[model samples]
Target: MARVVVEVMLKPEILDPQGQAIGRKLPQMGFEGVAAVRQGKRFEIELAGPADEAAVERVRELAGTLLANPVIEDFEVHVAE
Candidate 1:
């Protein structure tokens, strides 16, 4: 089986409250020098066959339609090494 990765992230304009809360808490936890933080979702997909162009395209389509919200989020699909 081949592994594919689908990363979904909020758009730049969209507010990420979870990320912001983590960022604010990081400094208190002694993790410093952090400018900003944004959160996203990652999906590891196991494919039945090789991770070829066709497979990648299918994952991309899935990401666009189901994995990520096109109105407020963006997504990228890639084959895992």
Candidate 2:
């Protein structure tokens, strides 16, 4: 079996409203030294086959096509044997 880990994050230039909202509330919750915060998504997928370069490429294509928005977000895929 193979395990794939995917991390999705907004582009650096993109505005993260959700993160901003949480950052705003942190001060009121007495959490100091929180200068900035950004929200992101992580996905783990398990495949019933060996981890290979072709499988990794297919996973990357899938992420680019359906999992993340290429314009505003980026994704990284890690495959483990």
Candidate 3:
């Protein structure tokens, strides 16, 4: 079996409310010197074959079409190894 790691995140131009909330609250909790914050998603997918280029491409397609919003979010897929 093979594994792929997928990372999904909002585009830089997009506003992340959840991440903004965290940033705003951190200082109240005694966390200081904050620069910025962003929230993202990560997925570990396992396939029943080798982690070849085709397999990685397939995962990238899936990420673009299903795992991430192409309009406002970007995704990356890579072999675990």
Top candidate, metric lDDT: 1
List model 2 lDDT by residue over 1-81, tens digit each: 899987899999999999999999999999999999999998888877876888888889888998899999989999854
Candidate order by TM-score, decreasing, is 1, 3, 2
Question: Which residue pairs in model 1 clash with each other?
Answer: none
The lDDT-based order of candidates, best leading, equals 1, 3, 2
- lDDT for every model? 0.95, 0.90, 0.94
Q: Check candidate 3 and list the clashing pairs.
A: none
Per-residue accuracy of model 3 over 1-81 as CA lDDT, tens digit each? 999999999999999999999999999999999988999999999999999899889999999988999999988888888
lDDT of 1: 0.95
Candidate 1: which stretches are off by over 4 Å? none
Report the number of the highest-TM-score candidate: 1
Stretches off by above 4 angstroms in model 2 are none
* Candidate 3 ranges beyond 4 A from true positions: none
* TM-score for predicted model 3 compared with the true structure: 0.94
RMSD each, Å: 0.7, 1.3, 0.8
Residues 7-64, model 1: lDDT tens digits: 9999999999999999999989999999999999999999999999999999999899
